[model samples]
Target: MPIAITGPNGLLGREVAKVFKKEYDVIELPHDILDITDLNQVREVLSNHMPTVLVNCAAYTAVDKAEEEPKKANLVNGLGVRNLALACRDLSIDLVHISTDYVFNGNTDTPWRIFDVRDPINAYGYSKYLGERYLETVNPKYFLVRTSWLFGIGGPNFVSTILRTATKQTELRVVNDQFGCPTYALDLACFLFKLVKTGAYGVYHVTNQGITNWYDFAKEILRQAGINIPVVAVSSDEYVRPAKRPKNSALDPFPLKETVGSLPPFWQDALSRFLSETQTKECLD
Candidate 1:
């Protein structure tokens, strides 16, 4: 059976394509080739391929920019998902939709469960929530995975940004209030591969097993890279952006142990592997 992936060029999408290609016949559908926002186009493309599984990595991920261009965000993340869900439902294609932790209100101290009430505070979160609703309602055979603090090689991410800034600066000020798990895109991709194989059709919360604030995460990044730098911790208010981020967006991997047999490797281990891969890529270039 062929597996089609949307947004295959994105951070997690790239890794998902790589992982799935190793075992399955993968159909890579970049936005230019398959604009999911266009319903007729989505139907036409999926109908032509008729893949067994459709991995929707396509999303409006510009967190801060979403504040200004909410319509565009909803178009891609909200109604765009409805298009895919409708087509998948009609075609009986299993939909593997990637979601986010932003759907929950950040005020809670504990980790968010898979069935937690969704109360998104920002435009981006609301848009993703809309997609979740559409997918849940339209497609029954779907894997709705919600993750957070993604850093990967396929695109510009926090890890790359921090490393780049470290070269020129002596000290870095990162938000210490916002806490969540740091997920390596490759790790997440591998998890999705394992998950889709089990025929488990429900919502799942997945991330590298652990929780830490941005300041601590940045310090670890510098430490793992063997870079000596001072990471100054600051409150969220001090580093405010166009978007209001949740203070705590940590997702609880409750059902993952039962579904996948074990929790993912610790966040530190994933970080080490990511740094090694980053260094190797840099050297090869």
Candidate 2:
């Protein structure tokens, strides 16, 4: 049986498709190609391919924008996932859904555990939580992987944002209050490929190790890219947004150590690898 991946053009999905295709016959499904929100489309596509595993990297990830358009977010993240779950169940295909650490309220200081009660403080998180609920209840064979602060080559991410911003400005102000671990998309993809093959069938927290807030993360990105500039760390209150971010949404690696045998490399190491791969000179221009 072969593996199929949704959102093959996305940051994580691109890597997931690349990783799986190296080992198994892979089907690539982008949003335009397969709209998960439409039940008829999902069922028809799945039925036609009949892939053994379906990795859902597609989601409505507009954090602040979701506040204004909660319905759009829910339609894609919540009801859309429900449609995929229902189809996967009928087709007997294993579903692997990508989630965010924002699912937690971010009230606690420590790392959020696997089974921590989900209390999303933002619309985006709540939408993803809805998807999780649908996936858990609807499908027996499912992998719910919650990750955070993703940075990769294909997508517009924080790393790219900081790099692009630094070129125009001498000093950068970043929020220091919120905290979470950064995850390399390729690393996450490799792990997911290994995970589905295991048939663990449960929740897992996957991210590069270590915790840091936005300000510090930005500083590290510049440092890695050999960019020298003044980075001023500011509190969340100083740099407010439309959505409310968790104070500390760091996820704890529980059974990842047991199931995957090890966690992904540290955030700094992953950042170094990303820098090495990316065109730092072009980012500055």
Candidate 3:
């Protein structure tokens, strides 16, 4: 049976489609084609596609802006998820939904596990958490995959932002307080495919193995690109933003390792692969 993927135009969605296209009948649906917020539209798409698997990559990911636009965030991340879960339940289809580390309050010094209690710190996090809860409660066949610090070729991401700034600036100041694993979209896509094929349906924390602050991530990006820009580190207090970040949000891979029998490679290796595949030399040139 075919698989229907929402947010097909986004970074992770695009990668998922690319990876799954060879093995499965992949149906790519962007928001312009089908807004998931509308239950009727969601039902119609699901009915027409009649997919065995539904991968929900669409979300309201504007962390800071979500505070100002809580309603829209909730509608897309929370209600949209509920609509999809209900439809999937009725259709007896499996669901693989993408989530974020923002679901945690970032208060814990240790890495977060699947069974960890979630207490989101921001509106965006809360909305995503609500989606997770709804899916778990309503749907029996679901994979709640939580990831963080994602970047890829299809969308503007942290790596691209840093590369762009490094070209024109001699020095860059990055936040060093917040810590988490940086995930590559392609790696995540491949892992998701394996999970589906194996039929290991549950919440799994998928990301690069090592954890680092944003400052270090920026420095590594510049170093890999052969850029000579100076990436200086600054505390979160010095570089304040509209949204609050967790001091430490590294995810533990005990469940993934135990279930999947292994874990994804380190973040640096994934980043290197992404740079090689995307041929980011254009950006440096």
Candidate 4:
């Protein structure tokens, strides 16, 4: 069986394609090659490939920028998803759709479950939530995987930002209020690959097994890199943005664990490994 991965050049998509290619006939498609907003394009690509599974990593993930460009975000995240879902249904293929933690309004302290009632607060969140519902109606056998705080080597992410800032600045002020699981993209890619090989189909909250605020996460990143910059904690109100973010987007890992028969490493461990790899890469470069 073959697997087609959209956004093959993205952070998670890159890792997903790299990991899954070892066992599956992988078809890599980036946005320019197959724009998700065009239904015919999506259908043509899927039909040509005739893949058994479609792992959709394509999304409009600009949190704050989405506020100004809601339609652009919706075009990619909402309508784009609907096109893929319909195409997947027509082809009798399983759809592995990547989602975000923004679907939930960050009011509760507890982790969000796979079956939680979604109440998105911002433009990006609403767009993703709309996409989720669209996929459900169009495809029954869909793996809706929700993850958060993703970072990897191939893209610009929070971890890279913090590390870069810490290396130059004396004091780094980070938002302490918002909290969620810091998932490494490669680990998420592995979990997504695992899901496709199994018969289980539905929603899965796949993330690293722990949660921490951004401030602490930044502090830890600097600590591991042996950078001695001081991390200052600031509230959400202090650092306002156009899009409202969930204070807590931590996902429950129990369901994915039971489904996959294993769980990913903790956020701390993943962070350590990522830093070590980055350091090794920099030394070589």
lDDT tens digits, residues 159-195, model 2? Answer: 9999999999989999999999999998999899889
By lDDT, rank the candidates, best first.
Answer: 1, 2, 4, 3
What local lDDT score does residue 96 receive in model 2, on the 0 to 100 scale?
96
Candidate 4: tens digits of C-alpha lDDT, residues 1-285: 798889998889989999999999999988778999999998998899899999998988889999999999998999999999999999998899999999999888899888888999999999999899999998898999999999988888999999888768889999999989999999999999888878799889989888899999998888888889878899999999999889888988767878889999999999998888888988999
lDDT of 1 by residue, 1-285 (tens): 799999999999999999999999999999889999999999999999999999999999999999999999999999999999999999999999989999998989999999989999999999999999999999899999999999989787889999999999989999899999989999999999989999999999889999999999999999999999999999988888998999899999978879888887889999999999988998999
Clashing pairs in 2: none
Candidates 3 and 4 compared by TM-score, better number: 4
Residue pairs in candidate 3 whose N, alpha carbon or C atoms collide under 3 angstroms: none
TM-scores of all predicted structures: 0.99, 0.97, 0.96, 0.98
How close to the true structure is residue 218 of candidate 2, measured as C-alpha lDDT?
98
Residue ranges of candidate 4 with Cα displaced over 4 Å: none
Candidate 2 off by > 4 Å: 280-285
Write down the TM-score for model 2: 0.97
Q: Write the per-residue lDDT of candidate 3 for residues 77-120, one digit (tens) a residue.
A: 99999999999999888999999999998998899988899998
| Model 1 segments more than 4 A misplaced | none
Q: Higher-TM-score candidate among 2 and 3?
A: 2
Supply candidate 3's per-residue lDDT for 151: 94
Best by TM-score: 1
Q: lDDT score of model 4?
A: 0.91
**Position 34, candidate 4: lDDT:** 90
